[model samples]
Target: MASGKWKKRIRRAKGGHELEQAAALPYRFENGHLKIMLVTSRSTHRFTLPKGWPMKKRSLADAARIEALEEAGIEGKVSRSTIGHYLYWKRLKRVFIPVKVRVYPLHVQCENARWPEQKQRQRKWLSPDEAGLLVDEPQLMSFIASLDTDHRA
Candidate 1:
């Protein structure tokens, strides 16, 4: 599967590193213009993509799709190939763990009114530039900027 290739592409640390996560960049077309979806983080409430720890039994892409379903209440075709990767610090108890996130693009085909995190987080559909401004992570912002061209291609 492409998972092996994805693993090979990751730059490993010489000694050790923080855990990795999977995320989905959900997008859809609105009046021929591409719009991307961003969801608020549960605690920090920052605008972010749907992401979570990797699921042991599912491929990374599948895990990404699951995250989107749970966090954004959306489902769609997820690309097995990763669009890109990013690093972010996740707060845990007393420490901030650096997390490497593998991102997959999901062409959202459905949005459920009620889903697992519907009450916990807010979801919004914004233009690529608008979405970029909403996100805090620099890597994520670049990814958002690239979404318009990537989605078309």
Candidate 2:
């Protein structure tokens, strides 16, 4: 009972599974000040860490590195160990999809890389406490707190 155009539209409307993503929390001590890199999205301008879905041909760590450079404009060394994982609902096709995220701790070497392609992106270096508060996820906040405590010891 539907037209060709309507059927095509319906086919396109079916949503797929939520993609997997990896994120990095960059931390460093600069001149006795604790600093972390936080990024604002290009579309939503939501403040978050640098993260993205892993590329088909690349390892998860490499994808994390590339995300940091593209999103935050920073080059850093990522730890081999995973800090933690989290889950959230992502909106797609007017439905809430579940997404799994892996988090890694990065030792940032440079914070001032240029990202002309990301016109709406913004990066800031905030103290651990401030960064923890800024992050939206509770699990991520706990990880940041733990990192802060570890740094203090």
Candidate 3:
């Protein structure tokens, strides 16, 4: 998809103001290959990166890290900068709110056997290409595809 088209989709999705959210792309190097940890959404059970609303007193990057820990049970260093962003509609009670998600890269150092929401979500490690195929968002897929190369935003 074209970048402008995605932006237009984002604008159309949010007729009002876009909610700011953060996400973590938890990753690690295994056997000289990059592996990314993805978690399924509790409500939809669809493959997606750990993401949530902005938390008070936490930077977007830190919020992303916290979401990863709570949702995926994985932790490590998170970049202070965002590598990329994507637009997605967040389903609420009766309306689907548009959300602008700032994605931060996290270097996975540990995976906990027990963490909050462990029972509510499933985590899986996949190659960048595999993850890109699994997620439904096009911009998110682009971010996943760039995992093998160094990127900054």
Candidate 4:
């Protein structure tokens, strides 16, 4: 439903510029140790953080929170200020989408929630260094590094 609406919106945009989006990486501290959740694509099975384009009529922060729940299947408090953004090309139509992702550092308080879409996907809990290496983008790696530092402090 939302994806269909998003496709329609994309069609209506001038010059076919993709809409801005936001995402979140949920992390938590248990016993004074920081841990983060990473998901592997069911298709490619590449480990990465949860992310998606924001739906129409939704705030960036709200969208990020939704993505965290839908993609990562975890609910937590999301930060107001964005950590950073990154850009990449979507191979579906060879369109270069500039995604202004807002990194919400979530403090997860629970787990074992329902995530139907991500059930086939592999999930793992790893340290920040491991997460940084899992991400392909340099900027994203840097962002994860900063998050690691923040988690430590």
Candidate 5:
């Protein structure tokens, strides 16, 4: 998707709004129905996709795949192209920072019985609509809703 479509007002301090770099919308086929994985955030316990900052020496898609392994404990073929982008507020020590995340779709091939952050977060598999309802951000929810028919991934 075009980045212009997601452009929004970004509040900044001395530096600027932070970019999360990459995020993975992990999905799998369960009995012919598509289900997405949503993980609880470490601090707030709110539902969110597996995401993190960019890693050194890795492409955004690779970093997104790594985040899925670390945050959600699942890995598979990550789409080479981004599906969409969204803006969210990340709570900091005294303020909320705007974060722009480029999203990629992961066609989940397997889920590990044990992986990093296995105990820190609870993962749930739900239909796209159900997952959208659980997520807090309107843009993120819209992205999830778009996935139902989006074929780029």
Candidate 6:
């Protein structure tokens, strides 16, 4: 469990400042080259990282790991420290709310044969450069392009 800001919840606020979420940046070193995994959005079928709201009784990193498993069917080691963060707009019924996401680095161990949301999402592995093209957020695109080398397992 986490305390302080990580534990706060806000339904609505100005500039979407009250909205915060956790995201998993799934990656692996493939033959010395970095590869990132992107999943299709259920409604739009657009590409994006696997993300969701924080869950009760879970660390933000653990919450992010669960999102990866549910949305992309991948399991792996998740870093307690965030690699970085980015902003994105989440579509609701009649409004698109901005969300600030803290990204946890996930070193993918394996993709499951079956998992939740498997029927609703499609997963693809691409180079950091390739992944950047499909990722809509400028900050996320830059984050992928850089792909910080100093990650701990």
Candidates in order have lDDT scores of 0.87, 0.75, 0.87, 0.71, 0.84, 0.84
Error of 5 at 51 (Å): 0.3
Please provide, for model 1 over 28-107, each residue's C-alpha lDDT reduced to its tens digit, 9 standing for 90 to 100: 99888999999999989999999987788899999999999999999999999998999987765444557899999999
> What's the distance in Å from true for residue 48, model 4?
1.6
Weakest ten-residue segment in model 5 by summed lDDT? 5-14
Clash-forming residue pairs, model 4: none
Better of 3 and 5 by TM-score: 3
Question: TM-score, each model?
Answer: 0.88, 0.80, 0.87, 0.81, 0.86, 0.86
Model 6 misplaced regions, further than 4 Å: 1-11, 14-17, 148-153
Looking at candidate 6, the ten consecutive residues that score lowest on lDDT are 1-10
lDDT of 2 by residue, 37-110 (tens): 78886656777788876678977777887788878878789877778877766554445556677888888887
Candidate 1 overall lDDT versus native: 0.87
Candidate 2 vs candidate 5: which has greater TM-score?
5
Index of the highest-TM-score prediction: 1
Clashes of each: 0, 0, 0, 0, 0, 0
How far off is residue 80 in model 3, in Å?
Answer: 0.3
Supply candidate 1's per-residue lDDT for 137: 86
> Residue 142, candidate 1: how far off, in angstroms?
1.2
Per-residue alpha-carbon lDDT of model 6 for 1-153, expressed as tens digits? 244433233236333455878999999877777789999999889899998988889999999999999999999999899878898877654566678899888999998989999999999999887899998899988777766445312
Give the per-residue lDDT digits (tens) of candidate 3, residues 20-136.
889999999888788988999999999999998787898999999999999999999999999889998776545677788999999999999999999999999998889988999
Runs with alpha carbons beyond 4 Å of true place in candidate 1: 1-15
Global fold similarity of model 5 (TM-score): 0.86
State model 5's lDDT. 0.84
